[model samples]
Target: MTINVPGRFEVGTTVVRRHVWGGKVWSAMPYRVLEDVGDYLTVASWPGLRGLVSTTWIKAFLDDGHGRDQTIQELASGTWRLGWWAWQGTTVRSWYGLDAYFTVRQYFDADRRPLSWYVDFDLPKQRTRMGIDTFDLLLDLVAEPDLSRIQWKDVEEYEHGRRLGLIDDRAHQGVLAAREEVVGLIESRQGPFAHDWSPLPLEGWRTPVLPVDVRSGAVSSGLWIS
Candidate 1:
């Protein structure tokens, strides 16, 4: 797969996800800039919501996943991982983030048909930026695809990390708000899980080119981010 090396993404243009905060970018996922939303820029990752949330729907429903079809969806600084005092491999291959009571995830088979949809319970995504860069707290939610299944992967370690002062708090409130909003989405099923959710990505369009930095251990890593 070939990664798009387009000139720096133009405002409102779609670009692959890089470590907006650090590490490496996921080449498979595509996101379009949606204007800087004061604290952070809002970019819509593709299949862009139309099939997921728009009236012009399809097999698409907005249950979140690694739209770029990457093996790892994220990475954090070494310090963040060290603070956790635990390891979930070194990178993210396929993962999503959630907090509060639960998080919703939509899965599909190779053919793009709905595989299973489920929720996970865990700590809310802690969003904080370092030097104008935003990143999530390094914690994870472990759950199965069974609709009613859920559990947190790391509670003590996360609390321990916080005690060690690894998590930044300036955006703690804001990140909680964000996490609440995610919960709202799962609760209401308003956007991607709407009754009309359809038009799922199929065949060649189901994924994007995997980025080199994360391609090495693609199947082994998964992340839960905010």
Candidate 2:
């Protein structure tokens, strides 16, 4: 579905509690909507992580629960400008595990649906390649394995070993269980996978703590709000 906004979406505030794979849970961090430019919306977070998230990333806008939106943009360079945001504060203290600048962009199909979203991770002086890295894990979750072995341990291991250490101590188990459940649904052909993950929120979006594992060796739980 497309976002039908009269103008830009009124930026709202929410707290995003991020849990890295093997790390601690950063809680009660605030994020405020800074700009909503039709197809895309930029939001600012405390401990400061600016998110140029697609309106499509929004599962729910206000605490009262509203609809969602999408993002679409292109620059002259082959480098299509998708969205931009800035994150503040030391990465060590806040939830997001890694300390760096984060930026996100999207490529769309003729119908305006996102073909793929790319993320860039900028560290202090040190720069890392930009792109999606979790594509493999997402494939594994959707393709072959049935839901029988869906355990948090595997995800935990993967997150800890592969990405920075961040995991919600309180909701870890539940999140793992929920992951398994979503996998089961996918294996049964009841849901969408990475290839077909459209409809805004992933089938597992509402499954608390299931955030995008950023390519920066850091996993963004996307569980925070301002």
Candidate 3:
């Protein structure tokens, strides 16, 4: 389904994303909408920033109240830009765990191999008067592009989160399932992972993120700001 104006999140619009740790608000992230194409939109901190996020509000859901990340969307959309960038924040009712960033495309170079996925351990997003927000727990998981390797970063931090009751069993399991599911997609070469993900038309656009002092997270580093 395409996004129409009036109900659309227009380009150049600034949205607030908050960072959370152990269920408390640590900072607020301000980002700009770079593109608002029908199938997908891109939001980033700004140029030279390290993270990019894409996805839209929930299109539909079952009464069971299941709201997984757009891994399903990644499969169903069938339309993709041949890149593996991820963005932050969410609009649906939040889930408590890590956020998985899946890579369906890779850079076109001799060393084209890239990490297939990365998981940002964080609290689920929360809606506030200021804006929609989530917290970063500082731990992460990385998977080699070929799906042959996986590793964790900041293990101590995540352990701390569990001690604080932030990273609970449900959250941990959810994150694992997400990571496994995306790896399955890449390994099977299905859906968005089809066609080896050769580059498409991204043209001249970049992601933006707020400075560390003001706000920062997995996708906190970027080229421009809102």
Q: Each candidate: RMSD to true structure?
A: 13.2, 18.2, 15.1
Ranking by lDDT: 3, 1, 2
Worst-scoring 10-residue span by lDDT in model 1: 51-60
- Candidates' TM-scores? 0.39, 0.24, 0.44
Q: What would the per-residue lDDT of candidate 3 be over residues 193-218, giving only the tens digit for each residue?
A: 44343333324543444443333322
The order by descending TM-score is: 3, 1, 2
The alpha-carbon lDDT assigned to residue 151 of candidate 2 equals 29
Which regions of candidate 2 fall more than 4 Å away from where they truly are? 1-83, 86-108, 112-158, 161-165, 191-226
* Tens digit per residue, CA lDDT, model 1, 1-226: 2222322223444333322223322223343343332322333333322111111111111333222111112122222211101111111112233133233445544344544553333233223211111133434443333324445444554455445443445334543564566445545655333423243323243323323333222222123243
Q: Which stretches of candidate 1 lie over 4 Å from their true place?
A: 1-14, 20-105, 111-134, 140-153, 195-199, 210-226
Give the alpha-carbon lDDT of every model. Answer: 0.32, 0.28, 0.40
| Model 3 misplacement above 4 A | 1-8, 21-24, 34-41, 47-117, 123-131, 144-149, 189-226
Worst 10 residues of 3 by lDDT: 89-98
Instruction: Please provide, for model 2 over 1-226, each residue's C-alpha lDDT reduced to its tens digit, 9 standing for 90 to 100.
Output: 1123243334342323221221122111223333444333343322334443322223333323233111111110112222333443322111111221222323334343534433322111111122111111111121222223322223433344223222333234434454564545445644222233233222222211212433234333322211
lDDT of 1: 0.32
lDDT, candidate 2, at 73: 14
